[model samples]
Structure formats: structure tokens, C-alpha cells
Target: MALFNKMLASIGIGTAKVDTRLDSDRYLPGQTVQGKVEIRGGSVEQKIEEIYLTLHTTYIKEQDDKKYTQTAALEKLRLNDPFTIAPGELRTMPFSLVLPNDTPLTYGRTKVWISTGLEIKNAVDPSDEDFIQILPGPIVHAALLALTDLGFKLRQAECEAVSYKLNHHRPFIQEFEFIPVTGPYHGKLDELEISFLSVSEERAEILLEVDRKAKGLAGLFAEAMEMDETMVRAFITKQDIPQMREKLNQIISRYI
Candidate 1:
């Protein structure tokens, strides 16, 4: 029976299993995530080579005129050194990691999760996945509120693949689309797209693409040539939150 059990464990029939439990499922960018990795042993003794946690999300990528969803690792954390587990044993290890500042918010079709994995030789490694919700940080949240106060309503949000030159930190970026519904820009602009290129406690670097409403011959011609759209970068700090409405108005008006 011992030999049979060993054989079964080797083939993952009774191999060790892993599960990760987070202190909370909701978090903000740049916050610390605390969790525990639980291991349940199988019918026989097995050696675990390593345990690791990876933060992952999906982004849309275009290839050959077709779009595909791709999984990406935003960050990784390795825990507990190699150890041995006896039959029917249980072990729990605590861990902590700083979430990446560029982690995308849980919006639209974008989903974020933490994957826990175990490395074992000659066996199918056991793994676990825990989905998590990422909320906008203080600075980013303030900007969003400011935009709403200025009469722009959020239309959509999504993550899309980006070039290395655009963002050296990550392979994708999250974009938020807004349209004027009631305020000063109601009749002047077509739409607005915003991307938080980089964000932190101190400041947030934003990229704004302003689309102007086409008018007569000159405006129609500019639209056809793609000149009706303008792209610009802006930096907002904690102090700027109070005046974000005015500041955004000035910046966007220059383009319109």
C-alpha cells in the first residue's frame, strides 16, 4: 500500500494542494497585500521545492488585425523555502507584498487575481487562484471626481497593450473614456480619454486625449486628417485636487 501511495502521489493523484487566502479581497494601487498560503498534504510524504504568488490581469492585444486577451503578471512574490510534508499534514505560511503602483483598476472586462503555485519535481505542481478587486488610489480617485464635477461622465474603461516606449514599466495601460453630458464642454467637445500613466501618493502623471466636435469645412477636414484630436500630458499632486476642475478645464480648453 505504501508503494502504491507513493506512485499515486508522484502522478498528482494524492499530491499536496495549495490555497491562498488574502486578508481582504479589495485593495488600492501601491497598497500592501497580506495573505496566507495554506498547504494540505496528500496520502504520502512529498517535498515542496518552492512557493510563489503572482499578481495577474488580462489586457487586450491586437495582432494581425485581430484582438486577443492576454494574461500578464504585474508582480511576483516568492515565499517559504523548500520543505518536506508528511502524509495528511497541514502548513500555513503568512506573506506580505507591496502592490504595483501601475496595477489596473477592476473595471469593465479587466479582472485581477493572485495565483499561488507550488514547485515539485516529477509531479503536476498544485496551484490556487484568488481574484481581487483593485480600486483607484487617492490621487487618481480625486481626478476622477474632479472630472465628474466638471460635467464629464465616465463612458468606459479598459486595459490595452502598449508599446515599450509608451510605458517602460508595464506591457499594458488602463484607459478611461469620458464624454461631456451637461457642462461647459457639452457642445464643444466630442469625447475625452484619460490614462493614468503613473500614480503614487505624491502625484499622478496623466495622459489626456481630447476630441473636439467637428463643425464646418475646416473642422470636417481636420477630423478626416485626425487633427481634431489632441494628446497632452499633465501632472497632478495632492494639492491640485481642490482645483482639479479648473486645472482640467484650462488644459482641455487649450486643445478644444
Candidate 2:
């Protein structure tokens, strides 16, 4: 017996059945995810008006200085224009969906949920929700590793809305903060902020901001620095612990 049969048996629905199959268990951003939806008529003939799939994501939003949990439809697809299923008949439909390049990377594993359903008139709805684990790409991993190698320890991470007019592009931005491991720079630098703008599998833009401590003397203020993608990648590939310390010293020396 098929898995759909087991599901239908549990639901006690003798009129309809639904099943979904994903092409792969893992995917990167900007990649195509393909899948198929299979529907089988139960013990009796059924009118399958339409089938649809919805991609859903759970995120947090802020309003009135308060945060709220919410879910949004990332993508949607209509599979059929209205069809009928005879008794014991099987029907299948294929679908292809593209994931956004700027999708936030989850810590361990996050679920990409796809809901498949059939809309029928004057009857209970039949649907299935499948979860797929999303993995981080190479660029993301490399950038994080570089930060750790620079004697920075992870503090906290959050996602905030950014404007495209500002050239941020994506609807959200992931912010990570790190503190200097140990050195005279510990008290001199408040923290380092990093954000990743992944454009593709191999290309990612990193934004770095340094929060410098203010001096007590006159004409002293905090300074900020920003590095582009090339500089960041080069730093990742070329710098060791001593070299990174020297680079930081150079940056601080310029301000003094």
C-alpha cells in the first residue's frame, strides 16, 4: 500500500487522497526546487476542482514597540484548472519553485513548508504539509568563519527590515555582533557588526562596522569603518591572527 493510503486511512476520508514528493532534500538560494503532487480518488468518484501549493515562512514583526509572531506566504502555485477523479483513479501534477537568493540562514535546520491541497465543493478539505530542511551556502559559512578567525566572538543575531532604496535589496537583513576576544583592543573597541548580502552561491557581500570607544580627551569621538566584498574576501583569505591584529592596529592608527 502507498503512503497516501495510510494517510487517508488515518483521516478516515474515503473520498480523496493527496501526496507530495520533493526532488531533493537540500537546496541553496536561487536554485530551482521541483516536486510533484499526486492525488488519488478514494472509494467513490470525486470532483477535484483545483489543487494549490503554498510556501510558508514564520517570522517576527514589530509594531508599536512590541514584537509579534506571524506567518507569511513566500510563494504560491495553482496546479489545476478543475478536474474530476473517478473511483480508484490516480492523478499527478509537477511543480517547480525558485527560492529567493537573500533567504535568511537558520542556525541548525529550518523547515521550508509546502502545503498541498485540493479544493472541492461542499466537502471537507484534503491537504498535506511537508517540511524540508534548509542549509547554509558556502559563502555564508566562509564569512562567519572569517569573523571568528579575527578574534571576534558571536554576541547575538537578529533580522531587521532594510530599504531597497538604500541598496540593501532584500526585505530583511541579518545582523550579527561580535566582541573582541582579548587584547588592549577589547576596551578600545565596543563591538563589531557584520551583515551578509548573499547574491549567489559563490558571491556574497559583507558589511562590517566597527564601534570604537570614545577617548576621554578633547577632540575624541568614536569612528566607524565599512569594508566592501572584495576587501572582506581578501581579508578572509590573506590574514592570520598576527596579520589581523596588525590590520586592526592600522585601522585604529588612522583615527588617532
Best by TM-score: 1
Compose the digit string of candidate 2's lDDT tens values, residues 175-198: 777787875447656677666755
Please report, as a residue range, the 10-residue window in candidate 2 with the lowest summed lDDT. 224-233
For lDDT, the strongest prediction is 1
Clashing pairs in 2: none
Candidate 2 positional error at 112, Å: 3.2
In candidate 1 the C-alpha lDDT for residue 191 amounts to: 94
The predictions' CA RMSDs to the true structure, in order, are: 1.4, 7.2
Q: Model 2, residue 161: displacement in angstroms?
A: 4.1
C-alpha lDDT values of all predictions: 0.91, 0.64
Q: Please give the lDDT score at residue 52 for candidate 2.
A: 91
For candidate 1, write residues 120-232 as lDDT tens digits.
88788999999999999888988888889889999999999887767557888999999999898998999999999998899989999999999999999999999999989
CA lDDT for candidate 1: 0.91
